[model samples]
Target: MDRRRLTARALAELADVTVVSLSQIKTGKQVPQETTVQRIAGALDYPVAFFHGADVDTLPAAAVSFRSLSSVTQRERKAAIAAGGIAYLVADWLHSKYTLPSPKLIDAGAERDPATAARALRQAWGLGEKPISNLIKLLEAKGIRVFSLAENTKNVDAFSCWRNDEPYIFLNTFKTTERSRFDAAHELGHLILHKHGGSNQGPQAESEANSFASSFLMPRADVLSEMPRVQSLQQILRGKKRWGVSAAALTYRLHKIGLITDWQYRNFNIQLRTDYGSSEPDSMQRETSTLWKMVLDDLWDQKLTRADIATGLNIPHGELENLLFGLTAASDRPPLRNDRPALSVV
Candidate 1:
């Protein structure tokens, strides 16, 4: 239901029932008959048992790092949370069969400064000041379970949480590649810096995440050395590609570091807003889940398919397909190596 972004009204229409009747059945106010259950299962492409599964659990909005919450609607947030639930279930199942990397993030929530926390995380992860070639791969290698959200909603950028003491990130692949990277870094900040957990609002959680993302992507020393005397929008746009970040994000970082004066920053913002708006002039290839790809290959070698896994989980095959996106291994390709370094927690 979340994957398709089907509201009660829409789902009721698809199930050939009235909105009130469907709502009553969903709310447990009335029990659905066998025929009605079959109709709903068919409409949702889910087995009747899936709805009854005790394993069906969802992460709340408060438990996640949600970007642009004001711009996001409640319905969109609910849909994203529900989608995350499906991904979490699939990941939990995969973990039981595969020796996946352990969580590598340390508790950096006590640090008041975002840049300090970012640097600390870099040191702990042994990532120095060098640019991360692929943020998704780096996170996966470090034991962060990344998944793409097919919620079909543009308002949600990305979200992260700690499930079963392991970090999980969900990105909305519908956005531009640059935005997606920033979203990935932002969620990483939440995972590392907000270890204790708090509301997304208050005490500048969003700002801290933004700061951590900027500093993490472009370290202070490296970015300072790269900054030119006369900063221009085009130069920033071109330079942003190296760090896999958006022009606006780089510009803000530059401004925060005092590399660019207020006058120059304001002028650059005017040009960037008028010309680029939300679209990135130059974009990189979309990053998919490395861990998921490897897992799918391992499972495929055993002659098990997504349909088999779906049956084991009591979910529809399409749900698993949507959760995996492009991470599923192709039958024509050989299995991936399982020799990647295993990250550890504590």
Candidate 2:
């Protein structure tokens, strides 16, 4: 069998065989029974026939894929829902412009096992020390289709397609501001790493995505330069322009990369809570959202109304109106929901 991915324990459990028996199979000393093939196939999310007599060369290094999250669990579902509308919008936009390559479908649940995936992603993006901003633009430039789908929009924060050795990216509109940023980076992680099978990302995927988000959104060099020797909101605010992060987020970023002391971080969090409870900080404000405004305006110019967009994306027309009116109203919310969008025409 190919060395795709299978812990000895996981294979044993799936094959319904003893650990010793599973070891023998790995060593090519013995073959398993049909029943064992069934169990292992189910566990690996693969077909039983393949287990019996599949070529190792046909298998990939790892089995990685993402599907629209089905569980109604709030957070997971919300992620899909949030990304659904936006993904539709993005995909449609790409369809209208360039003849994008077919996108590879992905699971929305690859946050698990993100470490190895993260490294693979970094290599793919040709990114290292720099932070990633304007992820939508980056994806578009890569010729991957972006679209919107309202009906089946699973609280999707974002998704990546891996097809023909290329990747495309998508984001959901149902998330919060910070969450959206993180989602874009997360999907970017999938585009770079992972395989094409089931959408299940174990643990390493999550770690890799998180790492990509941190490095992509907040480059380490920028974080170091901005870390205040003396804790001051004013200093932090000044740093935001170059770093392109909110004060609170920047504060956390400082601590994340070991720029700030733990004592300083704790005190800073308290200070921020006291200063800007439930309201965004002045430092967090930006003249424009580089990607958000650009994409929205471009789509609007292409003769796509928010209402028309909603229909194409399978979202409620009224909901589309709400988002355009600067009033995001919906039962399901993404982790990073945004009330502010680009300029709307009519």
Which prediction has the highest TM-score against the true structure?
1
Model 2 worst lDDT run, 10 consecutive residues: 56-65
Candidate 2: which stretches are off by over 4 Å? Answer: 1-97, 100-133, 144-178, 196-204, 226-230, 283-346
Q: lDDT tens digits, residues 1-346, model 1?
A: 6655688888998989889999898778998888888888889888888877775667866787788788888778877888888887888787677777778887786455889988888999898988888998899888898888766667899999987788998888888888889999999988877878455544488888888888999999888777746457878987888888888888888888888999988999889889977787778888777766656665566677667788889887666766775554353356545643232212
lDDT of 1 at 242: 81
State residue 30's C-alpha deviation in candidate 2, in Å. Answer: 48
What is the clash count for each candidate, in the order shown? 0, 54
Off by over 4 Å in 1: 1-4, 7-13, 16-31, 274-277, 329-346
TM-score of each: 0.87, 0.50
- Candidate 2 accuracy as lDDT: 0.50
Put down candidate 2 lDDT per residue, 1-346, tens digits, no spaces.
1122355776677667888987887688988777776776666554454445433221121332233333334444433334433344444444565354344333333444444444444455576645555555555445444332222334444555553454544444544445555566666655554544343264555556656566667766656755536466667666655545556667777787777789988987788789878555653221212333444455554654455555454444453433332322321222232444343333
Q: Which whole-number lDDT from 0 to 100 does residue 101 have in model 2?
A: 32
